[model samples]
Target: MNNLLTGLKNILGVGLKPGSYLNILYLLLAFPLGIFYFVYLITGFSIGLGLLYIFIGLPFLLLTMFSWRLFARFEGLQARWLLKENVEHDSPARWSEASGFWNWITSRLSSKYTWKGLVYLLLKAPLGVVSFIVTITLASVSGVLIIAPFIYKFVDYELPWGAISTMPQALSLTAFGLVLGLLSLHIFNGLAAVFRWLSRNLLNSGQRLAVAE
Candidate 1:
């Protein structure tokens, strides 16, 4: 009975938790960041590959590779900070440990994490779109409904059901909104968990694999 009660409390109290707000913020940032990452990465790769015949293309290719690594590292950090995920990032080989600069670069390029991170980065674009749309749509509807009492009279309010004119209607909608808000938090939490898993498995699992070998 006690455990059941605790579970119920957790479900209902999601909005009161600070983590819920963090999840929302993370989801909100996903759309813009995803678009930026997708555009930059695709452009960089296309340009780098297209110019490979020219001597200058070598530098472009190298720069694009380095850029992706840096982006991956930033994503790992962001996951740790926002989602409270402990992502053990892939570390580069030390210059001192390598025979030369080229050797160190090769070592980094050969690592499994390098490719995995790239895949994760690419996946973010689509995932971010879905997460952003769901978060915004649900939250906006709930917010407008919650505030319907105060704004119903002032604004020309019309939902799919109909216009809300009476205080009773507004109050009932507000109650429904509160429930919807709680559900949204749960959805956000689930999405955050997916990101956390991706970060842990793709962004930094190279270190663990290296140790195993």
Candidate 2:
């Protein structure tokens, strides 16, 4: 746990600029892909539902298994644009646009990257849920703390979170707000850490260029 905390700290401490925010923004545009992936999984998993499109469904779903490189490409672009880290991406490998369907599937199946990419895709949902919860909780907590003191003397406003039993009608309430702010920062550190480690493992898997001739 201590090591994990330290790693989180290290990742959060990395100098990030406005571009880093844009890197995250890049994900917003990929929402369509995310939705497609979700549907792909749902349909693929349904025994009777996906039989009609089995060929495309199974292959496309499997192809998503290799999308980690696609995800990493964005990360690499971010690294270069945000942190001046110019990671190389060999032009081509197992994925061949012109190859026959069977060749395409076989090529991806045989490569380590296909597996890695698939793994990354699999983890996305869980990480997204965690991140959403942490971010929202932190923001809400901080907001309550920050705003509570302003109306402490007023009648009463029951916070949705019944935790603030005592109306924040005092200076201490402001202190609580500060704590929430710091706590949010702490969680952000964790998010950044996990994201970095995941990116490294999934995106940086192929050290050698396997560009097909």
Candidate 3:
């Protein structure tokens, strides 16, 4: 009985942790960032591929490659700050004045991280959509139910069981909503963990590029 009670407390008390809110915030931003990355990559690649024969597209393709590396670096920073993951500060490597522009460009083109980061950037678009949808849906439903007691009289409220007309019914709905909200927090935390793992693997996995003299 004690073990069961402890387990219940651990599951139900997720909202008490500050990290829960951080996870929610990260998940909330995932959708917009994912969409932006997708659009930028697609546009850059399309234009680059289309104009390659003219040689003008070479620069565009190079720019697109560099852009994704930067995006992956930012993602690592975000994971470190928001998800509390130990992600490298400089991922996919960046240009250095000492290294020379050509050396930097060659290092990036040859690094495995460049392609892995590209794959991650593309995958996040769909993942972000799922994260945003689930987070919004759960939070909205919980919020509405929690506030049922305060606005039931002003607005017509109906539940699956029946219509809510009495204070007792409203109070019951509020209680249920509170429980659901707690569960939603757990779900958000789980989603954040998934992103954290992905970031660690794709963004933080390989050795840093050595700067050529």
Candidate 4:
């Protein structure tokens, strides 16, 4: 019983932890970053493939691939910093140091990690949107409910559908919001865990293949 209470207290107190704040910040950033990545990927691929009939398409594709590699590296760094996890990737020699431009391009195109990174980028937008929406909604609703008593006392406002203009109602709403807010923290933590797993598996698990080669 004591252990359960302690665990509940710890979860409820998650906001005091630096990691919880960092995770929230990371999720908030993901919304915009995800949009940018999705836009860039679609635009770059369309332009590159559209011009493939001419030699221009090849260079465009190469540039796109190079840009994606850099973006993936940035994401890896972000994950490492925010998630506080080791995110590994293949060595530069595997794709960057080929004898010729074509060879370098071919190496990147053939690399498994490149395709995996592309998939990750594609999925990031949707995952980010979901995370951002849930986090913001929970935070906002919790904030409003937690302050219901003050709002009722000081402001002229109509109680929303199920809400009542009474002290007990206000206190009950506050308690509910507080519990929900703590649960939201746990949800955000779970999201951070998922992202860490994705980064470790998709962005950084090519070392063994590199060694084999």
Candidate 5:
């Protein structure tokens, strides 16, 4: 697992920072809010503005912002971490003396890189949606083959291709099923590889953002 993650950092165009493993690091922060977002959507909690703001609206927006900054910092950090470079990040030593919420927020705002990183994080959801749909589609076709015999009962007998009105025989179906099941693994692995590459590029903006910084 460490080697795979490390390879991701060092791979061409990935350019993750050594200590910045920020992408993996900050994923935890966004997790709980994600759960809440799903629940809120399911419950249809849009009637009350105040409640919606606190529960549904606010968490979603904040998570979006949080995900963005966190991942950007991750990308930047991963780059530094992998390359073993000590890029200068804004020093926060003096902020320990001053004690105010507004002051801390101001200090964070001063570093524009964080905001830049945040923008990158916001893009993650859309890329994720595409990745999910493609992967799920390929995997679902494979799953249908795996359970071909059982599928006859569950799936309505209308052929989408309009090729056959009646269901296929169990023996032939099983043969095709076996072939599909085996081939599906190869296809899934290939699709996963493509998606993982896309994710590294889309989510880990370490190389480009680092140069921009």
Candidate 6:
């Protein structure tokens, strides 16, 4: 019985940990950032490629590549801070000191890492949406169920699925909520792991390129 109680305590405590909260925050931020990245890349690439025949498209495409590189670096930093993972990326060489705009563009275009960064940015939107939806839905449902007993008593109402008038019923709902909340935290942690993996592999120039080669 003591072992059972300890296990229960551990399960309940998982949701309240600081790291779990950070994972939640990271997932929440991913949604908006993903939408922005998807829109920006889609628009930029579409316009740039559409006008590739003209003289102007080359510069636009180069600019888009540079933008993706910067965004990848930012994502690496975010993962390091929020996911508490070490994401090492290769620093871009100082091409401006050596030559002009064309030189910098040529370097970016030639690098496989630049292309991988673009791929990561392109994938972020769908992954972000999935993670955000799952996290928010699970967290919200768990939260509501956890407090349903108190709310039912104070507001003189029962939940749609069942009544919470009796103490046992209320306790059951609370217990279920506790378990569900822990499950939600686990889900968040899992998604955080995936994002961290992506950041470490796709966003990092040095590691990804080396592995590919």
Candidates 3 and 6 compared: the better one by TM-score is: 3
Worst 10 residues of 2 by lDDT: 22-31
What are the Cα lDDT values of the candidates?
Answer: 0.86, 0.54, 0.88, 0.80, 0.44, 0.81
Native-vs-model 1 lDDT? Answer: 0.86
Clash totals for all candidate models: 0, 2, 0, 1, 17, 0
lDDT for residue 138 in candidate 4, whole number 0-100? 88
Best by lDDT: 3
Candidate 4 Cα deviation (angstroms), residue 57: 1.1
**4 versus 5: better lDDT goes to:** 4
Ranking by TM-score: 1, 3, 4, 6, 2, 5
| Runs off by more than 4 Å, candidate 6 | 1-13, 153-161, 207-213
Better of 2 and 4 by TM-score: 4
Tens-digit lDDT track of model 5 for 1-213: 998987654442232232223322223233343344334433332333445645666555444444445545554454344423333333332456537754544444555555544443444444445545544564566566556566666665344554322346534455675666545444434433433343344434232222221
- TM-score for every candidate vs. truth? 0.93, 0.58, 0.90, 0.85, 0.39, 0.84
Q: Candidate 6 on 96-202: residue-level lDDT in tens?
A: 66387665555566666787778888888999999899988998889877886777576443568856687678778778898898888988898999998888788
Colliding residue pairs in candidate 4: 88-204
With a 3 Å backbone cut-off (N, CA, C), the pairs that clash in candidate 6 are none
Model 5 Cα RMSD, Å?
Answer: 11.6
Model 4 misplaced regions, further than 4 Å: 1-6, 94-97, 154-163, 166-168, 205-213
Reference-based lDDT, residue 194, model 6: 93
* Reference-based lDDT, residue 127, model 6: 92
* Best of the candidates, TM-score: 1
User: For model 3, how does the per-residue alpha-carbon lDDT over 63-89 read when each residue is reduced to its tens digit?
Assistant: 999899889988988898899999763
lDDT of 1 by residue, 1-213 (tens): 999999999999898999888988888888888898899888887887888888677778788788888888899888988988887777777889878998777877777777888998899999999999999999999998899899989977787998889999989989999999899899999998898888888887564234221
Reference-based lDDT, residue 24, model 6: 92
